[model samples]
Target: MKNRNYIHLFANCLITKGISRSVICDLQRSKYVLIPNSFADLFSKQRYYNLKEAPRIFDQENLSIFHEYVAVLKDHNFIFSCSKKELKRFPQLQLKFEYPAKITNAIIDFDKNSNTTIKDIIQYFLIPYNCRHIQIRCFEDMDSIFFDTLITEINHCFIKSVEFIIKDSFEQDYTQIMKWVENNRKIKSLVLHSSQENKVIQKENYGFGIVVTTRQKITSESHCGIIHPDYFNITIESYTESLCYNSCLNRKISIDKSGNIKNCPSMKQSFGNIKSIKTLDSIIENPDFNKYWTISKDKIETCMYCEFRYICIDCRAYLETPENIYSKPQKCGYDPFTNKWKWDYESFTK
Candidate 1:
C-alpha cells in the first residue's frame, strides 16, 4: 500500500463472477487465476485502488498484509504499478455474451445412389448467411464422378470445412479417396467405416486434412470429438443465461438420411424438408426450436458438482433418462457424488 503508486489490471485480463467465484483471465497470455476466498475482500477493493482508499479497505491492523499481497500481484504481472492517469485510461473488462445463430454447422445424410445432384443439396440446405460447415454421411462408396461433382459444388458454397463419413466394403479405394482430398482443400476430416472388424487403429495426415479408417459404424456421438482444456470449451455453455443453450444447439442444425431438417439428427422433431421453402432463417425464429439450446451443464443432474462440467460437451440426443431432457449424458459413466466412474467401480468389483 505504501510502496506502489497505483495498480492497473492488465489489458488482456478479465475478472468474472462475484468475489465468491472470481476468475482472472489473461487472454493474451492464456492464463487463468482463481483468487482464493480469503483475499476476496482485498481483491474487491483493489478494483479501484489508491493510497487513501487502501487504509479504509484494509485498516491499520491489515495494511501491512494488504501491501504484501499487492506486491505478489505485481510480481506475477496480474496488476502493474502505474500512474493515476494510466489507470484511468486502462480498458474495462466486461463479460461476453454468446448469441444464438440461424446456422453454424450441419450434418447431411447423402445417399450416393440417389438422383439428388450436388447443386440441389447445397441450394436446399446451405443458407449462406447462417451455415458455415457441414458433415456429409455417405452410406455407399462415392465414385470419382460423384466425388468430383460434390467437391466442386461445396467449394462454390465457400464453407469452412467438410467432414466425410463414408461406409466402404472390405477393400477401399485409397487412391481415389486421396485424390478427392488433394482436390478439395476444404475436406478437413475423412473417416472410412468398414462393416468387417478392423484389427489395427491408425490415422494419417494428408497435408492439412486428416484421414481416419475404422471398422466400427459411425454414430451421432462420433460426430463430437474429444474435449480438451482450452479457452473455447464446450462445457462453458453452463455460464450463458441466453436461451441459445449450447453452441452446438444454438442456431445449429442437421439434415438426416431422409432429408428431414432438425436441430440435430438424433432429435426426433423435424422442422421440414430441405426442398420446402421453410428456410432455416424462418424455422430458427420458432420458440420450440430454440428450446434445447439453453440446457446447460449446470442445470444437468449430477453435472453441477463435476469439475469437467465446464469442459465437456453436452448431449441432448442420448440422456440417462430418455424421457427427461435434463437428464445426465447416458455415455458419461462418471458419478460426481462418488467421484468415481461407474466403469472403474464395476472393474474394481470384478
Candidate 2:
C-alpha cells in the first residue's frame, strides 16, 4: 500500500552535512555513520518520501544508488517505514539542554610542587553549586596515599563522577588502582598517560575503567588538544549543548598546577589564583571568565563546515591562528572539504 510505503529517518538520526560527505549521528546509540553528500541532500529535500515517488526523483542510472542507500539505511535502523499520517507522532529532536548543576564539570591540575589542597577545593565549591564532574590531572607520578586521601574526601562529597589522569610510571600501583575503581561508583576513568603500551582495562561492573595511552607526555597545558575519532562522544546531551555552547569550555572551570584559576588550564589568561580567590564564586562570576563559553562550533572557522562539529570535542586553547579566537584547532588534521584525514583513517570501523 502507498500509505505504508513512506520512509523517514528517526528524529535521533542527526544528518550533519560536510562539503563532500555527511555524518549520520545516532544519538541513542552514541554512534555515527558516514554517507555521501548526495544521500544527505535527498533525505533533507524529502523528509518522508513515498517509495512509489522515487522513480520521478532519480534517473535510471542513479536510481540504483538510491535503492542501495535505502537498503543500507533500513538495515542500520537509521530509518523506518511508516505512513504519511503517522509522521506527526514522532516530533523533531530537542536541541535545548539544561544541566542540573551550576558547574557541570571542573578540572584540577596537580604536580609535586602544587600546594592547593582537595579540602580547600571541596570547601570552596561547597554543595550549593554542585560540580557534577571533576577531572584531576597529575603531571608527576603520585603515591598511593594521594589517592587514598582524595577518595576519602570524595566519599563524603556530592560530586557525581571523577576522572583521574596521572603520569605513567614503571611502578604503578595497579592493585590500588583496581581496588579504588572497583569500590567507588563515582570513579569513572583512570588514565595513565606517557605509557610504553596502549591498552584498556575495564569490567562490566566498573566504570569506564583504566586506559593507558602512549606518547602522551602531558607536562604542561600545551599538550591539551589532539583531535582523534576515539575522543568523539555522540550523545544527546553533548549534541544539544554543542548547538549553543563551546563543546569543551562551556560550564567548565579549572585550577592549574601553579594554583592559577582559569576557564581552561591550557588558556594563558588566569582569572585569579586559587589561594587568593574565595570559594571560586568571584572568578566564575567575572564577565571575562565566561567570554569563550559561548563560542560554539557555529562561530568557529573551519569547524563550522565539519560534519563532526557537533560530536567532536573542540579546543579553543590552541588555535591554528593563535591571535584569532575563532581559528580552528591546530591539532585537527581532518579536512571537511576533501573529506579526508591527513593520516590513514584505519580506526574507522563504521
Candidate 3:
C-alpha cells in the first residue's frame, strides 16, 4: 500500500485515553507532518517571497503544543485567544482578505434599557457598511412597538431583508405577527420562534408565517418547522469541522467576538482589536493573520482523514466545551465520533 501522505486528527476532552494514545502514535509515525502553530508561520514566510509549499500535516492538539511550536517558528502566526499584551509581542501578526458583502449581516439581541438605540445602531454600524440584512431579538415588552418601529426604519432605509426573533410567549397575538408579514411582502425571510404553548398559532395560519418551535414536544398536527436549539450538538470528525470552517471563511463573515476579531465567536484570542481598526480589511492585511486564514484542512490533523470534513461546521464553541460540543447536540440523535446519523437511521430503518 502507498504510504498515507495525509492524516487528520481531532481530539477533545472526551476521547478515551486509548484514542489519544493512538493519535499521538500516528503523529510520531508521519513522514513530514507540520504542527499547527508552526504551520501558520511557515505559510507566512513563504507568502512574502511569492512561494507556495504544501504543508503535510495539520495538528489540532491542545494549546500547549500550539504555543510551543509557535515560539520556535521564525514567522508570526495569528494568535487566537491571546490577550492584548501577548499580541503586542508579535506586532507583525496582521493579515487581510476580501470582504463578502452579500452575507455580511448582523444579529442584535436587544434588552430593555440597552444604551444603544436599535435603529441608530443599525443605521450607523450596519447600513453604512452596506450590510444586506439585520436580525433583531427583542423582549416581549418591546416586541409590538419595536417591531413596528423596526419595520418603518427598514423601509426608510430601503434595507433588503429583516428577521425578527420574538419570544414564544406572544403566541396568542398570532394575528399581529401575520399582519406584519403581510404588510412587508417584499421581505425575503420571516421566522418566528415560539414556545410549546404557542405552537398552535403557527399551525392555524400556515400561509403567511413560518413558526419555529423550541419545545421538544411533537404535536399531533404540525404545519411549521421545529428547531430545538439544544438539539444542535454532535461530535463531528475533524475534517468535517474544517469543511465548516472553510465554508464560513469563504463566506467572509467574522465569527470572532471576544476582545479581538478571530475566527469564531467562542474563541478567546484576538489578532487585533476590531473596534480600534474599524474594518476587517486592515486585520486581514497582517501577514501573521493572513497565515491563520490560509490554514487548510491538510494543515489540521483531525480534519485530514475524515470523510465528512467538507460538510460540517468546525465549531470553536465545541472546542470551548469539548464535552458538550463533542457529544451529539442534545436535540440531535447522531454520534459525532462514530460519524453516524442515528436520527436518520431511526427515522428510516423502522
Which predicted model would earn the best TM-score? 2
User: At residue 34, what lDDT does model 3 achieve?
Assistant: 27
Model 2: residue 234 alpha-carbon error in angstroms: 0.2
Q: Give the per-residue lDDT of model 2 (tens digit) for 146-229.
A: 877887888778877788888877454466567667787677787888776666645434445554555456677777777889
TM per candidate:
0.65, 0.92, 0.45
By TM-score, the better pick of 1 and 2 is 2
lDDT of 3 by residue, 241-260 (tens): 34323423322233221224
Q: What is the lDDT of residue 321 in candidate 1?
A: 93
How well is each residue in 1-350 modelled by candidate 1, as lDDT tens digits?
A: 33556776775554443313445555555455555445544446556456557877767767887777667666768787766766667766443555343566777776643545656656655654447678878766667576677778888885778887777643654666666676678888777776454432234455346666776655443343222233234222333322135634655777777767787777788888766643566677777787877776667787655544543466677677989977876656666555455653223324
Q: What is model 1's C-alpha RMSD?
A: 6.5
* Candidate 2 lDDT: 0.81
Q: What are the runs in model 1 whose C-alpha is more than 4 Å off?
A: 1-94, 98-101, 112-118, 168-176, 195-208, 219-244, 337-350
Q: How high is the lDDT of residue 33 in model 1? A: 57
- Give the higher-TM-score candidate: 2 or 3: 2
Which candidate comes out best when scored by lDDT?
Answer: 2
